[model samples]
Target chain A: MERKSIAIDMDEVLADTIKALIEEVNARTDLGIKEALLDGNKIRHFMPEHEGVLDEVLREPGFFKNLEVIQDAQEVVEKLSEHYDIYIATAAMDVPTSFHEKYEWLRTHFPFLDSQQFVFCGRKNIVKADYLIDDNPRQLERFTGKSLMYTAAHNIHNEDFERVNNWKEVEKYFLGNEEI
Target chain B: MERKSIAIDMDEVLADTIKALIEEVNARTDLGIKEALLDGNKIRHFMPEHEGVLDEVLREPGFFKNLEVIQDAQEVVEKLSEHYDIYIATAAMDVPTSFHEKYEWLRTHFPFLDSQQFVFCGRKNIVKADYLIDDNPRQLERFTGKSLMYTAAHNIHNEDFERVNNWKEVEKYFLGNEEI
Candidate 1:
């Protein structure tokens, strides 16, 4: 039988994109938006007062290239790679400019994965795998396989899918051992 | 029931990539390679003494951005979109630098497709669709859905899958109408 595969999202699940957004927005506009301020919605929802500020920052050339690798993401995913084929699927079509930078960032941080294991797309559901670990529920729309929701500030309230708060939990969920 | 979806490849299938490569290689290296010179072989296969010429050309930043669109591709795919959801899946992972350029090329040529319909990956089989239309047999490896091998100079000898010579033929294979 073919080994089961896992498709992991890039933004919040593996990369600390929200933290980078929060930092960049605060630097540009003095929005002073904290992790708590994000609450149950995305940074966009809080930007009604500062219209397009988030987009403006996100559009900067090197934004995604500088995002911090989420804690334990590289190590846990490396461990997970031993048992399941791992594909890093990112919705890059939304930000056309982010393509090359996102790829370079992955190469720098997750060097263990074959370059072939990377997938950049818009509709996450189109990625066929045994399991999908994503922070966005909408990205999982109509996916036939199991969906695991990676905890993000904006996605904390979403209860429709199985939730794993961090990479430690992800390790335990897949490998039954969080000690790694 | 959801409408059946078709995932089409970007390179030789929809974009006149090999033709562009031949033109560029001939201009730069004075190889004078022509359509007939490429008889059932890729431009790279003929470059025994000129190794890395193809790689250097492909690595150029604007190479993918300036490719010509295959004849009748846009109109036929537009008609096919009416019956099946359409996704343009490209193996951009092989050429990390080609990612953004390929996306912009599609946007400029196939304006009817939404940004979300684009998928860039290394393994084409990861894309879930009712049908995958591609020029490379390796890209169709292990696919569960029906596969159509779009004809290219190098892939002409390949008969592992159903073949369609051009966009008009592709229309007939899927839509049963080549009139467009």
Candidate 2:
């Protein structure tokens, strides 16, 4: 059987990048902003005072280096790779050092993932694939293929992906079996 | 090996009871609530006119007669039952008709689930089991056992259940390397 292809979003999909960034920025010099106000996925809300925080936090030693993989992502991807051409199609900004660090971390943790398959694009809606695994609701609706929303641990905004809480369902949907 | 006992929550965990309730109430003759304002776990800030609508909705046929199951729950539960003693532990108000109807609906859909194991209680936090699968974060925190939060498709409040998501992780935590 011809292997199916799966494209996964980067931020909040594979890694808890947003949470890490929020923690790193807040842990450092306080931006003097209310944490509750900056609770959700509105990245630019904290960017004003915590300028350069996103870049610095993502590049911090053991930031991306020590990122915890999404629950069951490693297992699901490994199993899916057995039957699918897996690709990391992300709507990530072109922050070279920070983005490269994420890729390196993914390579280290998910060694089965091909480094070349990681496509760092500004908009994932443009990409065409057999299946797309993303956390963004807007992006999910745009895809014609089977899509699994990667709901990050702290993301309370993308309620649409609530059904796709774990990688097991994604595995079941894409791979057609839950045992893997 | 002694089989592990698994506790399943009823509301958003097993059936789409909340959604059905909203739809039922909205379709009523008097209450003219245009949209359902379902919040993170609790349905707060509903139209004042819909106060009694909540009660009336519970009496509707579709609300009690044909509640939908959460995606992939039946499959996961059936497979899990192969290695576990599955029990339905739900927190239900003593609405006689609604209660009986829900029980009947559950029995009808997931026939593999032993009706004898179903226990409807006032508070799920007080329930005891080896494993508890629930969507409510409060229930998860209260239950000391290995609990897996049954995440909804648009939960938006997913961060709370980051530690546990899929049944595989729940199985791994409870059953270890025993072949399932």
Candidate 3:
């Protein structure tokens, strides 16, 4: 039998990038924007005047390396790996420095997923898998497989794909007694 | 009907990396090693005394961007794209700088293959495809799909998989009237 596969996004889905960015912005700049104010994919989108803040923060050496892992992402992905081929596909091309840092982050946090299970690319459409779990609907738009939108502050308004607010919801959606 | 896919390697298979490395080495250093002497995957393997030469040349900007296209690679890959999903999967994580350079190289040379068709990754095992065409037998060792060895100077002696000397042979093997 063919083993099923799942392509997972790293940024907002597995790693709390927005949360880290918000914390950095609040601490570094005069802008006191809270988490609730961040309602778009990019932190810059919410604050057009402070657009450079996002780029400045991301350009830091350890910005991507120090991101906190999303709640329940490690456990849920570990469980999913038992039955499916789990691949971590991240759009790391935009920031060239993040390539090795992201690779090290995955190795340090999720040791179960070896170098072979990671994909660092520009776009998600190049990926071929049975399912994709991502925060951005734009990434899932052209996916030929089942697209599951992991809820995020920016994507809360988008209602195009099946929604999973958290990792527990992901488990219930895929491994639930009900048919998938 | 499900469309068949083929994952192709970029370095020695589609791009003449070894040739470029040799040219750069001879032009910059006193080492006069020819292409025939390059028996291993890395240029450093052949020149153990001048081991740093490989790293030094690769670190130069546009090293990957300025590589020559392999003979008939563009035409053959274009032909293959008509019937199969052609993905250019390169093991580019070793050099972080090569990520964007390789991406732009593909965009400049093979315009037919969009960003969706390119995969900049570390290991080929993570890739999901019907077939994989690569020069390194080590990359093809654990692949579940049909593996075709593309002939290269370093991998010529390795006979673990079925070999194709050039793109013409690949065309004959895949879409020719005669059996592969």
> lDDT tens string, model 3, B34-94?
8886664556766778777788898889999999999988988888898898888898767
Q: What does DockQ come to for candidate 1?
A: 0.89
**Candidate DockQ scores, in order:** 0.89, 0.01, 0.32
Chain A accuracy as TM-score for every candidate? 0.95, 0.75, 0.93
Q: lDDT of all predictions, in order shown?
A: 0.88, 0.64, 0.83
- Candidate with top TM-score is 1
Question: Can you write out model 1's per-residue Cα lDDT over A20-78, one digit (the tens) per residue?
Answer: 88888888787688987677888888768888887788789999999999999999999
**Model 2 bad stretches (over 4 Å):** A31-40, A43-48, A59-62, A141-144, A153-162, A176-180, B1-180
User: Tens digit of lDDT per residue, candidate 1, span B138-168?
Assistant: 8776666999888888887887999888888
Q: Predicted chain A of model 1: TM-score relative to the true chain A?
A: 0.95
Candidate 3, pairs of clashing residues: none
- The DockQ leader among the candidates is 1
User: What would the per-residue lDDT of candidate 3 be over residues A23-108, giving only the tens digit for each residue?
Assistant: 98888778887777666555676667777778888889999999999998998899889888899998876776677678889988
Shift in Å, residue A61, candidate 1: 1.8
Q: Which 10 consecutive residues of model 3 chain A have the lowest summed lDDT?
A: A171-180
Estimate the overall C-alpha local distance difference test score of candidate 3.
Answer: 0.83
